[model samples]
Target: MKTRAAVMLAPGEDWKVAEIDLAPPRFGEVLVEFTHAGLCFSDEHLRHGGLGDLPAVGGHEGAGIIREIGEGVTGLAVGDHVAASFIPTCGRCDWCVSGHSNLCASAANSPGSADPDTFRFSLDGNTIPANCGLGTFARHSVVSAKTVIKVDPEIPLDVVAVVSCGVLTGWGAAVHAAEVRVGDTVVVVGAGGVGINAAQGARFAGAAHIVMVDVNPAKLEFAKRFGSTAEFDSPAKAAEYLWSVNPVAGGADVVIVCTGNTTQAVVTSAYEMLGTRGRLVLAGMSQDVFEPNVHLPGTQIVFREQTIRGTIYGSCNPRHEVPIILDLYRQGRINLDELVSATYRLDDINDGFADLRAGKNLRGVVAHG
Candidate 1:
């Protein structure tokens, strides 16, 4: 089948719309007719050569319908509504069996050549790579069966496609990874899709204070609607303001670093903002991993119990959190529409990323076939 897709031809370049040929499922794979694809920052990493990959089809978070199934696939049939999972969790893997499907070994393997199996997608009579193995940027894709997560019919496919990644990543970071608690304080370092979700998760977890820090003022306010107690572009300024309001625990209880591009200045500042026993979670680290400040804050970790963590897809199990979060949205508990500040058709995928990089939107969408 011929599918319309956007390809990142080179680093620091815009994606070009290309009509590519895609093959059907070979085995243990399923073909999804995508209806929507999300614009995530990680793709920006690829565009800048930070991810160190090339000639890759960029699309991780998306929603579509299962159109075909391979011979070995079961429990899912054609016409099933599904949101593409970035990670394909092999049920038998140690991580999956241990209730950590998010880290399934299969998810870390390369696409186009599924180590234990052959891929089903081909472009221009040749193989084309899928991001995280489920490239939803195209009109069609052949992915590992384990990566397809079912969604409710009531939810719009466009919304579900984007949320499964951006929303889940942020929310899961706060709720699952950080395990934020009621009356706690949280500092979200970016107010983009993932960071906004983190802000909301902290709110849902009943965090007493949720301070959002972002370079864009618009993102800060946008994040506020989702439940940010305060918004600031400067962490130091924000912390000072927080101290003014409550000086006793001047530092944040939990600091989520969503801004991937960390400079030397912010690196030290981020760590300095955390209080004793405070946790700092790196939600989106830069493509160019910078040196972290290991200088201790007076042995705070040992004396005060501080912790640092890197969160992947917010440490969420797709099968577990996708439905759970959708229900939260259905009950009017989460603000999804607010996150989608702009959207473009599949052909205009590049434009979507442009808006994301310009900091002009909280989130952008690429509607598929």
Candidate 2:
């Protein structure tokens, strides 16, 4: 099959929207006809030379229906409504067995699984990679069936697609990854797609106060609708406010950083804004050389006992969490529609990333054929 997709040819390059051929689904694979795709900042990283290796199709957050199922595939059939998980959870990996399916072993080879070590998409058989392997930028894509999850039919395609990454990442960071609780004060850095969800998840989890930090005015505004009790334009203010909230306002119980900025200074600041025994979760990615400089001072940690952890895809299980998160959306407990601040056609895809970087949209969706 041939597909029209936005191809990111290399690092520091713009995406090329063109027609390419798609291959048939192989073993344990499914082909989806996507109606909606979410433009994510992580994909933006690919455009700006992140982690190198490119000439790929990009679109991990997509909503569509199964059009075909490959050999050895069962439990998923054609015409089933599904949200395509960009990261495939093999269900057999050690992490999957432990309920942390996002770190599936299959995820490491997601880019290579399409077979021929090439791509279903090619101009003259030239290889093209898919961002997370479920390239929904194209009208249709053949993806690993293990990465696809059936979703509620009542949910809108745009709503489901955005949550496939942004919403789920943010929400899961607070719920599953951070395990937020009642009366706990949480601070979310970035205030964009992932950060806003963390704010909302903290609120839904009964947080006493939700503080959102972002440099962008627009993004800070978007975070407000998602249960952010307070907003800060800088981390300095976030730290100051953390101490100023109340006399008992020791510090933040949890801090989830989604900015993906690889600055040691930023990481250090995020780590410092915590109370005794506070948990700090790093949801952001640092540059290749950007290992954080963290001081686990015996006096600070032994007495306060701060725990620092890293989160991968919000520690989510798509098959288990997608529907659960969707139910919350349906019940109006979680704000899905608010997360979608803008939409684009597949042709205007690059503009979607522009909005994300400008912090103009909490999340952007691509309307596909």
Candidate 3:
């Protein structure tokens, strides 16, 4: 089958909409007709050469329906609604069984072709890898069963799409990784798509103070609707506010970093906002993979008993958390509708990303036709 998709042909290039050939799903895979795909910064990272093999179809966060099931597939059927998980989970893996599906062993080889010699998507007879092994940028994608989670059909696909990645990652970073407790003081840096949810998560966890820090004034202001009790333009100002309110600790109980691009400087600033026995959660992706971006004083950490931890997919199992998140959405506990600041047609994906770069949106979605 031939499907229209947004393809990133090279690094530092705009996404190009092209007609590509898609093969039928093989055993243990399924054909998904994607309805919506979120414009996550991770894909922006891919556009700038941060993730996955090149010449790939872009997009990792999406929601769709199973149009066809391949051989040996069970527990899902045609017409079932689902969301894509960028990190594939093999339930038998040690991490998955231990409630850490985000760290599933299969993730090491993710977003790559199932068969190295053959590809699921191709153009002009040249093979193309799907970003995160489930290129929801395309109208239809053949993805491994492991990269998708079943969702209730009543939920809107666009809402489910954002939760699939940004919402899940941010919420879990605060609730699971940071272990936000009642009356805790929390700080979330970078008030973008993911960071906003971190603020909401902190509020849901009963944090007394949920402060948002971002360079963009608009983003900082926008975060208030999502449960940010206060906003600041820089970590220093936020730190100052924390000190004034909680002078004894001189910082927050938990600080979550959700910047579009993580940096050594950002990590250091986030760490400075942590008080005694505080936890610093790094949920952002650094541009340089090999760079040692974290530089913190070991003695201070030892004396203060502070912790610095990194999380992928917020350290929450997709299959387990996706449903709970959707349930929260259903009950009006989480704000999914307001999270989508804009929506675009697939052909306008490049423009959508441009808006992302300009900080014009909290989260953007591509409505696949």
lDDT against the true structure, per candidate, is 0.79, 0.80, 0.91
On residues 1-369, what C-alpha lDDT tens digit does candidate 2 reach at each position? Answer: 788999888777777899998888888888899999988877776666554357778878889999998999989889999998877878887988998888887773332344446356675587666767778898998888887898877789999898788888888899878899998989998888888888888898999889988888877777778899999898788888888773363788898888856466767778778877788888877644235545445577667777888787788888888899899888878888877778898888878887776767777888986
User: What ranges in model 1 sit over 4 Å off?
Assistant: 109-117, 289-298
Considering every candidate listed, which one attains the maximal lDDT? 3
Per residue, candidate 3 scores C-alpha lDDT tens digits across 1-369 of 999999999889989999999999999999999999999888887786657788889999999999999999989899999999998888998999998999988762333334554359998998888887889999999998999999999999999999999999999999999999999999999899899999989999999999999989989888989999999998888999999876777899999999988999999999999999899999998765556899999999999999999899998899999999999999988898999999999999989999998999999999998
Predicted candidate 2, C-alpha RMSD: 2.3
**Clash totals, every prediction:** 0, 3, 0
Worst window of 10 by summed lDDT in candidate 2: 109-118
Top candidate on TM-score is 3
RMSD of each: 2.3, 2.3, 1.4
lDDT of 2 at 24: 89
Against the true structure, candidate 1 reaches a TM-score of 0.93
- Expressed as tens digits, the lDDT of each residue in 1-369 for candidate 1 is 877788777778888788887877887888888888888888887677656345667888899999888989988889899988888767898989998888888774332233423444565565656777777788888888888987887799878987779998899899988889988888888788888899989999999999988878877777768998888888878878766654566688888877756555655677777876788887876655444633445566777688887778889888888998898889999988767788888777777777887998778888765
* Superior candidate under lDDT, 2 versus 3: 3
Of models 2 and 3, which has the larger TM-score?
A: 3
TM-score of each: 0.93, 0.93, 0.97
